[model samples]
Target: MSGSEQAPVVGVSTYRQRAVTGVWDVEACLTPAPYVEGVTRAGGIAVLLPPQPADAAVAAAVLDRLDGLVLVGGSDVDPALYGAGPHDATDPPQRQRDTWEALLVHEAIARGVPFLGICRGAQVLGVALGGTLHQHVPEVIGHHGHRAGNAVFTPTVVTTVPGTRVADILGDGVTAPCYHHQAIDRVADGLVVGARDDDGLVEAVELPDHPFGVAVQWHPEEDLDDLRLFAALVDASARRRTGAYA
Candidate 1:
């Protein structure tokens, strides 16, 4: 590797440019965009992921250079991706997100690279690995208080399991800001919940044997909570960058 090359490069997901609430309009090198800021504050350079249908090999090559991958939260996944029919709360899902994130997530896991999924990103990682999500958190579960807005933040408590990565990273328990209506339902295969809400919502999950993977249904980049997970991800990624994996 060239000495001038950056250390610990992380690929971040960008929404497709389309209609409102369709695909996320993610631009290039856009730093401090909530989740991207979360990654940056943790000591990793954030690379915005854009949908490029004509460059699979090039994308894979670029992905190969990174030490880790991050799937940021945005639009809801298409109901059809899962085995369920469109529920009453189903919205127009982001197809590009499914395509790009799926490729990146599988590649990252296969390469023993560390990955962290937050909110929709978490659901993406979960569903990509054979899990499910509740169409709407409010429609069934009575858990309320999570509001949707860039300027507003919501609150909820999450109980962490001792000895779990989520617990060790954030310590004991954490209640992060939540804005999503969809959540993990069946719990992805090979993954386990590390935290939960009083209403039984799956707040966080961890991969049993990957380099380092965790998907959370809450948003920890809201500045309301202590950002421990980001630093942990970056540190683990740095280790991976230095051939420190078992």
Candidate 2:
């Protein structure tokens, strides 16, 4: 492809936490390897967007430089943002990350940038748009299958809603690699459920009005063999870059 048609620049959100690298422990901004690999494998340039002090203006300025945005799974969002108290199982508040990500979600929607949220990323999208979370999936679903803990990922069967972008990409059903304990509850107003599990728990959501806006409770990046979701996001971004998406 020519420079004008080069792969789109896709920004993936990362975690800000302490790490021990080469006997040196320090705070760093990072995400799992799969996230960056997924984007590159799907024909997009990957850029990591770490937590930083940000406002709407900053968010817009950041979005102004990218063709697509991706919110990856990480620590739990503070329940306070959605007007609730913490659930014992919930991870302690990552306030800075929450604030920065929320801004990106809001601004990305307004700008109609292609977006894909994974695991906690899905929850972030919901809360950023006035929705809430179940806090603990096992408590609500009566099953511990959604998350098996100990850095283990449970295999989940997901059924996509017909006529939705997720369905168009993933077909009727897919077994996803999932490790989330908190699920979206009372989905955001403008966002529609795009897929669900047999238990009726929401597995995916999409903004119909946007060129491309989709989020899944499962960790698509974990399944490197299946890059369909990532490819779809990159495809939409490419279309947007070439003025082929309306």
Candidate 3:
């Protein structure tokens, strides 16, 4: 089969956490089903990358086999990564996952892999690029609208800046499903703001130099009807696989 006819392999980072399931309570590496389904629906094969001992070489070795990478939403990133103390509301640091994903982000960007970040994934991208995060959104925004609680996704209007990859995929405005209590604070030098919420909080970011590096502070997988972001990533992956971007 031709490169274009072959489905691109996209790696989705998994959450390493302790959980109970069918009388087997133990630590597990898992991602929400929607993440896998979204990638598959977008014409790509999804592979889960579970957190383990990771470094630069490890990341490069893993990313070498994939056409694209997806940093799925998950727990809070260790605040120390950006030289800050954790907020009272921040979850305990998942240093293992933090290190793993950060290395992957660097490797993926260095190798020109099509990549997308969602929710916590967005925060990971920001931090990995030397940016800081607003540990608690409510403290900065004076409202809890970003997260309605009870695992519910609040609809927040996000407006994209013109001429950004995010704008190309999501258009000017969209009511994105957001449940994040943290967001990008100081965007790194190389990354540009792609979109923002009505409150002026950074909601998305993009790396202009890369072919496909976009991260949104919303949960797009929750809205099955809107597969624009996933489709865009998969299309980019397909192009990468076919050497179209080369």
- Candidate 3 lDDT over residue span 1-246, tens digit each: 964459999999999988899999999999999999999999999999999997899999999999999999988999999999989999999899999999999999999999999999999999998999999999999999999999999999999999998998989979999998999999998999999999999999999999999999999999989999999999999999889985
Write down the lDDT that model 3 would get: 0.94
The predicted structure with the larger TM-score, 1 or 2, is 2
lDDT string for model 1 (1-246, tens) is 763354677777777644433475544323238777878777788788776563456556766888887777777888787888877766786676687787787777777888898888888888888888898888767654665556465778889988888888888787688788888889877887889877888889998788788888888878624668888888888888888993
Task: Give the Cα lDDT of each candidate.
Answer: 0.77, 0.93, 0.94
Q: Which numbered prediction scores highest in lDDT against the true structure? A: 3
lDDT of 2 by residue, 1-246 (tens): 775458899999999999999989999999999999999999999999999998999999999889999999988989999999999999999999999999999999999899999998999999999999999989988999988989899898999999999999999989999898899999989999999998899999999999999999999999989999999999999888777863
Give the C-alpha miss distance for residue 39 in model 2, angstroms: 0.5
Worst lDDT window (10 residues) for model 3? 1-10
List candidate 2 stretches off by more than 4 Å. 1-5
Q: Model 1, stretches more than 4 Å misplaced?
A: 1-6, 18-32, 54-59, 148-151
